[model samples]
Target: MNSESLVKPCSYDPSFKVDIRSHEPLWCCAMTSSDVLVEMSALLSQLESICRKENEPSSQVSQQTGGKRKRHYSNTFQNHGMVLIERMTNLLQKTMSPVPTLLEYLESNSCAILFPRAVLYVKNPTAKHTPIKRAPMDGYFSQATALNQLISLCHQLQHDVTTMTNHKYIAHQIALLYQSINQLGNPKVLLDHRTSIETTFKKIKAELEKEGEKAPCLNSELIFWLQNLTSSLVQSVKTLSAELTSQMRPAMKYILQSTT
Candidate 1:
């Protein structure tokens, strides 16, 4: 899908929690989960196995506090996660032939679903600053969503890397990706970017630093998710800007070097 036809879901606003389930919103077309089944069942099964193994066996209890305090499986689940990941790799290779590269889409291929009939205006011919239109937007957004599903694949991949291989390299790559998301997709970017999404983003980062000082412990994975997405998204503004500028370049310079 190209630019104009990208789906921009109403959820992107992040206003009061929206309940769009009754019917698909104006921007998004109708979709049933089974319609786009790309064969992820095998990988899901591997993940479930990992979860089961991570749980404390009924017999293997440790004596603590007074008796064995049931230790909830948190990060421990993935600590022993490798063999399953290899299986996931096999699933990816075997299934999903000629899959669309992007996971986010509107109808069939969108990640950020747009509101139906919502118009996003643009000023350029080659492209516009406007958001996705109905048709193409759905494709891109769907592709984006599909890409996101692969995160489970990646989690498995990382788990696999944990075994036999030194995890430092893989861990660092994962860390960087997560970090990029934070640096780019800051919440401020969503609300009132024209007023400085960059500044708002910096403020959010600063707050995180401060919070880290008080309660150093945080759901690092979720945080990683937030920041990683944030960083990657920062580039989007630049991309959009370039598209607009390039498309309007000739028209913009029409009056320049005029002999009149």
Candidate 2:
């Protein structure tokens, strides 16, 4: 499926109410391996786009003294680059089982990582390098990794929305999260997350309306509300991951026996 199709429109009605406490089993319908593969590919494509946009030069200006031109990115772009770097580093650190060789390679070739920081003046020699050429060991691992990244992004979005005091970026983050969840190929989980996010968006809208300010900064109440929403999202994703692992154990065991 096209990755763009996974992103839901951010429009919502303030009157909408979402019931997040559904009794559906977390493992109601697990995605098949092929479905997982497609979703993972879509997610990787989205991540690659983000990395590309992050490093794209914002503007270029001629030098005052010389004819040379210098490339510079806006503060917003730089801040995003830093955040991407931080997310990647966090993912590496939080890996449940780390390979020493892989860690060494990533550290030694920082510029070649999946999401390298934006370099203003210097050109990256490994700009064309693609790190994740092939799929990971299994679809389960890929889905788990994507879910972890989604959870991390949710936390970052919460921090950014609260500290930045602006809800403008929240829509984009929600869209990305929706895309990630959609790629998981679990319709029920995706619907749950989408409902929760839309509910939160409406709450934010109501809060803004209460202050009679268009584009108003998020207040303390909204901040706490967002915190709870993000916590719920993280917990839901974790539960899904655990359920996925549980469902795949039999297949994993069969593969191991066959290989042995």
Instruction: Summarize candidate 2's per-residue lDDT along 1-260 as a digit string, tens digits.
Output: 64657667988887797844332225534444343323323333344444455444335555683655444435674454444434343334333355233334344434222223222111332343333332222244566677777788888977787667557556566678767766666645456667777677776656555555656666777677667767777877767444545434533443444335
TM-score of 2: 0.37
Q: Which regions of candidate 2 deviate over 4 angstroms?
A: 1-138, 187-191, 202-215, 240-260
The CA lDDT of each predicted structure is 0.35, 0.52
Which candidate ranks first by TM-score, i.e. highest?
2
lDDT of 1 by residue, 1-260 (tens): 65684776654555666653332224543333332222232233334334433342345465764565353444444433333333333333332455332222122322122222111110111221222223222233333343343344355534434342322233344444344334333344333422333334444344445532643222345345434444444444335343323333332232232212
Worst 10 residues of 1 by lDDT: 116-125
Question: How many clashing pairs does model 1 include?
Answer: 58
lDDT of 1: 0.35
